[model samples]
Target: MQMTVSEVLARFVSETDFSALNNDNVVAAKTTISDCIGCTVAGSATEVGRIVRRVAQSSGGEGKATIIGGVSGASAQAAALVNGAAAHALDYDDILWSLYGHPSVTVLSATLAVAETEGASGRDLIQAYAIGVEIIGKLGRAVNPQHYEHGWHATASIGVIGAAAACAKLMRLTEKQIAMALGIAASQASGVRRNFGTMTKPLHAGNAARAGVFSAELARDGFTSSLVAFEGEFGWARTLNARTVPDSDGLQVMLGKPWELTEPGIVLKRYPSCGGTHCALDAMIAIKDQHNLKLEEIERIDCDASPFAHKVLLYPRPVSGLEGKFSMEFCLAVAAIEGSAALRHFDEAWINDPRVQALLPRISFNPRADLEPAISADAVPAEVTVFARGQAFSQKVLVPSGDPRNPMSTADRRAKFMDCADGILETDVAEKLFNDWERLDQVAQLDELLSPLRPQN
Candidate 1:
């Protein structure tokens, strides 16, 4: 008899061992986790971070985990909720290409919180993370450009299930209990593209992370749910309107054969903005650097990308910093004029600056359906042309930097971490944290690593 989708996954999750993970994959996981911590710590001071922290504080239950960069503790679920939000608050966390979403914030936030709560070791957390990555990465392949095109936010829609899987692994639930956790997670999956560029966007990550912990804890206590919720008539795949419903047979065959975490790998961000805008930013920045181009020398900027990028980068004339992050026009213009679109650049004052406003209208975007077939969904292929100095200079980017094919160096990763960790942590503490993360697999407890991260009064 053929096994149900949940049964196949339950066996895979239950049977997988940390020792089975490749050394390179384990290194990738540590790098991704380190990047996530930097983002979460830096994001703690953001407006959205404060709001969630406030909510988590007021609704306090048993305090079992620490909120990164915050002074207090909360229940594992609540900490996951707030930390998940904080991690992606600046839209700067690591992204998995296959998942087509910010996977680390959603998966790590829940896994870390639960690890601390269960007194699980660092090795246990790593194994749970690998499990989550396997589930979500495969789901992304099964569902994709179609699922994303349907206006569903995969980070929340699919991430909740991955988070649950990670939490369930840490809890050591039986296969039946794991299936129940997945079913419970399916009901909670939600988030839409319509909410992009708003505070609610990051909230999706938090909610997904929280739901994972919630469902796993309930399932550990013998809570019941459908074993085949992924493929049932009213299940996640059908209900979410997946472009092509995933095949259980195919999914079962693919599990653990080639691990997803290392196959597509995670793409670290060079810019602290939406992934949609990176290709354009890369092309524009390259052109600017090559010619040492100045703003006045440019008459118009033309950018070409796939329709998916055109749609995600919806804002042509962004009025706020948050909106600026998603605007191709704003990001390219800033890169061309300012030479960098660093964290300090995406503020309301900078977004509404006279120079930025003047440059926005000069940039025009066009759809390039031709480039869609060759690249991954998260890989935005962009060609940017600048009509400057009465001459046209163009750069075409097939895969932006930080992509697996074009990976960031160890120095690049460290520089980014320090830039983010500045002001949030003392220099020595930040350096030590980064060093500690490099050897994270050997650490016994996550709390020992995270405890010093609490904001000093």
Candidate 2:
């Protein structure tokens, strides 16, 4: 039934009832929202955020939603664009390993902007967010991660579908409308890996998020798009993928799997660099702690990652901060020299440091096949070694700290929230946000939660 976008989207949304959601679903929704809020605030204070904010405001469009951490509010679409990019500015927003991508940054950035403008309650916001995250996760899994290998940005491509589903669900559209929204989103889906390590990479995420919202709104107003935008012979998979892609029914397999944030799930980063580099950082930090080797004593460092991991990291020379985050060379250099990829490691002078630059050549990568990556392999794996003062030390990190394997405790999440909210909000205000999100269904007004985000006098 070659239905319109709104018709299709509404149909799918009607099938997703929040009250019936399980505990994991609820928790995923809550943490992702809180995580995005934290990342957005942290990103806003960065130089990249400052620069992008000015550009967004200067190109002013409709004043629909506020761009958190920006110079001024812009239209919903514009705000989503800037806010989404900023949330990931530190390359530390959060990661959903299930999807092998970043979701909350894209889905929530647009969803939050729209929810605030639509006056939706916190409960409404979380429901929409879960739908978005779920949809993106399913879509990414369906694609079998080939798209990423083929150089398409999953966060942007799959994220567009998620945002559309979210917007359609939040707007209370019908199953048909929801399906159509997916169609509309398919048309707008795009993002490339070539832009990795650049502002444009995150901007791609912002674009996908904002575009999905726009697609949904248009669909709601009787807009139309291809009915089989996802499955048609000439549809998304065929056009975007060079090899065989997952069948449409593949989407149903994990469409509503137990919430992805709970177990064997999303990896909330404790560091601000590429997830690929985490195992190496994990190894290096432990070595530094055990031996207390001065940076001068370290002759060289070595990291072993799967071929795919090497492709993502292991860049020989990095000229920018974005590149620095993914550079095994750069990240290894910092971890050995500075002990962490904290904000301080990203300073301009530090990025170009003579000592770090000198060590770059000594840093090399060992590429291994994913042969039984772990006790039970989970996609990514690595082993790192260090040679310092005639002693060779090595460690293997099957999963990083934030992985569901080595999950962060709730208290850890709370501490992170507190850190992210420090300068912008007091403990009481942040506490309110953490507590209220759970009881959002009973909340009347959205202002209580949104209050902390407003610019102070």
Candidate 3:
């Protein structure tokens, strides 16, 4: 009998072994998990994170799952909701190019919630996360560009399914149940780019994590959904469109041959803003440095980027910090003035500063017509031109920092972890936790490290 997409996904989830993952992929998963933990911890301190945590805690049911920096032991779904929101609250979570969304938060938030509830070992967490990455990466190849072009936020729409797969694997669900879980997730998948610069964006991540856990739990208890929910007539593919959908044959051929985590892998974010703005921001910073630009000397700046960048960086004159993140003009203008787009730099004061406001009109996006037909998301080529001191300085960045080709170093990653952990943890505790994460797969219990994430009574 021929199987459906969900069946194939379910079997892959049920059959893949931890031993199938090589050392490098395992290390990548560990780093992603660690980074997510830091992001979640930092996010828990945010206004949005606090609001969600309060709601979760007020729900009045409790389990063993950790809520990052909140009190320990919320129910698994509640923990997933809070931690997932926190992980993405700062827009600092790791990203996967193929997936075209934030991958780590969805996977880790759901897996850890389930792991804690089951007292699952670290190896189980690692294995489950690896499978989750594979699912999202493969599906990204199949559904995105078209799906993304249509304005679906793959982070939530695709991520919910990926999170469900991870949780199902960790829970040791049967193959049939896994298929049902994915079908259930299919109905729940939804988010859009219109909410990019608001609390709703991170909330999308949280919703995916929560729905993923709910889907798997429901399926495990014999809740039924279509086995072919992914490729059926009324399923995800046709709903998306007939012309653009997952390439089933392509995905099956590539499943684990070259693990997604090892090849194109997740990119760790260096800035606390939309990934769409990174390349241009990097170019503008480089140009500013090379020209020794002064605020007074600058005349105007010009930028050209991938058309997708144009679509994402929609805020031309942002009035708020969140809106500023999706504005290339604002990001570049700020980088030109501040030399860096650090976590502290994104605030109401920065948005309203006269220097930033003045620089906004000076920088403009010019979409190159030549590259329009051939643009792809992975290679977001950007050009920055600065007319300052009567000289034109130009720089182009084909690959932004933190991309696998131009990867963040171990020291850089650690520094980022420390930066995010600043208010949440003591320096010593933060350092120790990072070290522990390096050996996470070898640990006997997942809680030893996660327990520290709870607020001290």
Candidate 4:
């Protein structure tokens, strides 16, 4: 008999070991993990992060896992919820094109929570995270574009399964238990694109992470679920994904073939806005620097983006910071006026700035089907035309900075970490934490490694 999709993934989770990872895989894992930690720490200072931590502390009771920036720790599930939300709150986490979502927030959050509870080594955490990302990326290949176009938020909908697999791996669950966990996670899978600019957006990631830990833990203790949950007539792929079903055999063959981390790779975000705005932001910033053009000198800025970018960049004139993250107009305007779109530029103050208001109406973002055929499948192309000083200057960017093809340097990554940690942690403490996390594979105990995440009196 042929194996089901869940069973195949469970077996992959069961069999893949740390030794199978190459140097590149380890480096990617470490980089993504450390970057996510920075984002989480930064996000923990946000309103949503504060709210979730309070809720988790009230309901979760005291447990083993550390909640970054929380006054106290919570259960693994609760900590995953808090950390996952924080990781995505700023929209600063890494992105995987294959998954069409922020992969690290879900996978790393659940893995870290479970790893701490299980007293697992850093190598174990890295192995689990890589395996989870691989599973998510392959599944994405099978159902995405269709799945995403159907209004599902892939980060939460797909991430739940990846998080379950990673948590199951960390907990050393058997293949059967892993399949059961995936089935349980499938039932919990849900997130919609309509909630893009709200607090519910980050909550999607948190909920997925929480559900993943809950599912894996339940399966380990004899929980039962259908092994064929992903392919059953009333199952995840069939029900959630319209007109598309995953090819289990093909996906199994492709798993870890070249490792998604090394091939297509993760895109570490340089700016703290929606990924859709990134290409345009890159182009606009470059044009600003090259021409030394003042904001007032520009008459109009036109950006032609992919269908995907047009769909996700929902806000035109945002009224709040969260909404600003999804506004291509706001991002480009700030990038032009400020010369860069940093995390600080997405606040309400910036959103309501008179200069920003004046520039907002001058920027236009539209979907162009023509750009789709010109670039690779993974490329996010943005053609920016700036009409300035009665002259038109144009720049088109296929791949923005921080992509594997055009990677960020070690210093740049460290600088991002420091920037994220600026207000939340003292400089010395943040520096030490970044240094320690860089050596993640060598850490024996997660507790020791995460000690600095808790705020000191």
Candidate 5:
């Protein structure tokens, strides 16, 4: 019997077993949740986040869910959008570089909000997260490499599917219900590369998270959609991207084996810009510190990277903060000038500063097969160089900082949370969340953790 997307999604949720946790999936689960908390804390006070919260509140979405960055309450849909954006606002959150370019942010944000609303236990929250990471991350591989190449935001598109699955699981829907949830979510999936460098970019994440929860909620109440939504002639695969599709047994492959969250793994980013440009950022920063190259002595800079990365990051002369995140050349230029790039470097003033703007004209990048390392199907290695005092110095980085292979230390991760929490949560509140995250299973109420998510400033 053919199923609907929601049906399969509901089934995936019903099948999840918390106690049988795979060791690798558990770690990925922790890291991803840790990553989302850090990003949300950092983005709580941003202009974009505040406005969106107001908009959601104005919509009269009264419910039990605590909006991560909201002062009071909102419907599940409202919380998902706000928290989802916060999870990736700084771009320093952990990554799934080999998969959806970005994940966990949208997946976990929705799960967290819904979990809180459902009055779910910590163990249950953890289980929902695992199912989400699996379904979404695997779907990334399914429509992958090309899904992104087709200009679809995998984090938003593929992520919606996972978010719905996670919500369904948390709600304990039947297999038939999951298929319907997935089907509804499939139709709701959407995002475009064109929105990069704008507030809409992060909004994609928030919207998808919200959409996933809504899809699952509707499914649980007898709503239905097409389960084979992905395999049809004009379905997700055909209409969104026909260039490449997962094998015929795509869904069957690894349904409960070789978890995608563990195998391909996740990337933890060191910088706050686009993950696409981080390899180049790492290479540039390394070469600068290594050779002690001062910007005043530099004449020009050049870089090489994956064509897809270059396509998204082609904004050499970025005009806004959002554009800055997508501009490899611009980000590297600023890093060279400031000696390092961090959360503050993404401010509009820095992005539009005359020096950064002037330097933009001197940098360029193109496709380079030599930069490839096969980190996975989508590894993006980068090479960056600066011409200074008539001498050329350059460096190459195969991957960015946050990959599971080159994971950030616990201290580094904590520090990241603090950095993002600045001006948002009280110091004590931030500290408490990190210390208590692992023990979330022990707590019956999520309010204590969620209460501090609102901006303290």
Candidate 6:
């Protein structure tokens, strides 16, 4: 009999050693992990982060894992929940187009929690994270853009299974137990795009991270679930995805063939907004800088984006910072007026500014079938046309900054980390954390290295 999808994935999770990873894979894992920690620390200061942290603290267990900026620790599950939300709270976490979602938030959140609880080393954490990204990326390739287009939030929906696999690996679960964990995680898979512009958006990551850790722990204690949960008639692929494409059957052979982390790779965000907005933001910012166009000279700005971008950028006229992150109009307007859409530009004061209000009406975002490609290695391309001073300045951005093709410089990544860490951690402390994480593969104890994240008070 053929191995089921869940079993195949579990076997890969069970058998693969950290030694199988190459230098690039380790570097990729370290970069993404460090970036995620910075994002988590920064996001922990947000309203959603505070609320989730409070909830996790109230529903307590033995405190075994760090909660980034919390005063103390929580259970692994609770810590994953809080940290996952914080990682995505600013919408600043990394993205993988293969998953069509933020991958690090769920993967790192669960693995870090479990690693701390198990006293796992940095290499162990790196191994689990790599496996999680691979599983999520392969599974995503099998079902999306159908899965993503069907109103499912891939970050939460597909993320739970990947996180489960990561936690199971970190916990040293058997292959059968790992399969059970995937099965349980498949049952828990759910998050909708309808909640995109709300607090519930980050909660999706939190819920997936918590459910993943819980699923893995349950499976370790002999919780039973159908091993064929991913490919069965009423299973995850069939029910949630409607139908898996032909590629779904071939995923078993494809796992770690080249390692997902080193291939298309993860897209670290240049702006603290939706990934859908980055290409357009890049185009707008470029046009603004190239022309040195003043706000008064600008007549109108129009963005022609892929169907995926159109669906994800739902908020046209946003009322708050959270909504602003999903608004193409708001993102572009800020980029045009302020020359950059940094974390400081998404607040209520900026949203309601007279200048932003004046520009919002002049910006138009539309979905054009022409821009939609049959296959894309990165986020779909976007075309921006800015009309100003009786002249049309048009730029089509095929790849946004932070993409592998247009990778951010080391200085840029470090700057981003420092920017995210600015107010959340003191400068010297943040510097030490960044340097330590940069050498994560050399670290002996994961929790000890993360000690600075806890509040001194």
Off by over 4 Å in 3: 247-249, 369-376
User: Tens digit of lDDT per residue, candidate 1, span 1-457?
Assistant: 8877887787788888898898988988888988998899888779989999888878868767888867545798888999999998889887887778999889999999999888988889888998898899888887776777789888989999999999999999998899889889989999998888888989999999999999999999989889778888998898887766667788878876688778888899999999878888889998999999998898999999877787687688888788888898899889988877799888898888888889888899889888673334658788999998889999999888888789999898888889888887889988888889878899987776887788666
Clashes of each: 0, 24, 0, 0, 31, 0
Kindly indicate the candidate among 3 and 6 with the higher TM-score: 6
**Per-prediction TM-score, please?**
0.98, 0.91, 0.97, 0.98, 0.93, 0.98
Instruction: Please write out the lDDT profile of model 4 over residues 144-201, one tens digit for every residue.
Output: 7778878999898999999999999999999999999999999999999999999999
What tens digits encode model 6's per-residue C-alpha lDDT throughout 1-457? Answer: 7788888898999999999899999998998898999899999999999999998888768767998888555799999999999999999999988888989999899999999999899999999999999999888887888888889999999999999999999999999999999999999999999999899999999999999999999999999899778887788987887336423348767999888898879988999999888999999999999989999999999999987788888889999999999999999999999889999998999999999999999999989887785543367689999999999999998789998789888889889999999988899988888899999888889866788999887
Tens-place lDDT digits, model 5, residues 1-457: 6543334445556866886577667767776687678787677678777777778888886888876667556788888988888676666666675455677877888898889888897778878877887777666666666777778888898888889888887777788877888888889989997887778878889999999999889988999876568776678777778345544355554665666666677777778888888778888888888888887888999888866576677577777776788888878888899777788888779977888877888888878877654434545778887899888897878767777666788888778777877777678877888877756666677777776665456
lDDT-superior candidate, 3 or 4 = 4
How does residue 408 of candidate 4 score in lDDT?
93
In candidate 1 the C-alpha lDDT for residue 190 amounts to 93
Report, for every candidate in turn, its global Cα lDDT versus the true structure.
Answer: 0.86, 0.74, 0.85, 0.90, 0.76, 0.90
- lDDT score, residue 275, model 1? 87
**lDDT, model 2:** 0.74
Pairs with steric clashes in candidate 6: none
**TM-score quality measure for candidate 3:** 0.97
**True-vs-predicted CA distance for residue 47, candidate 1, Å:** 0.5
Ranking of candidates on lDDT, top first: 4, 6, 1, 3, 5, 2
lDDT of 4: 0.90
| Cα error, candidate 6, residue 365 (Å) | 1.0
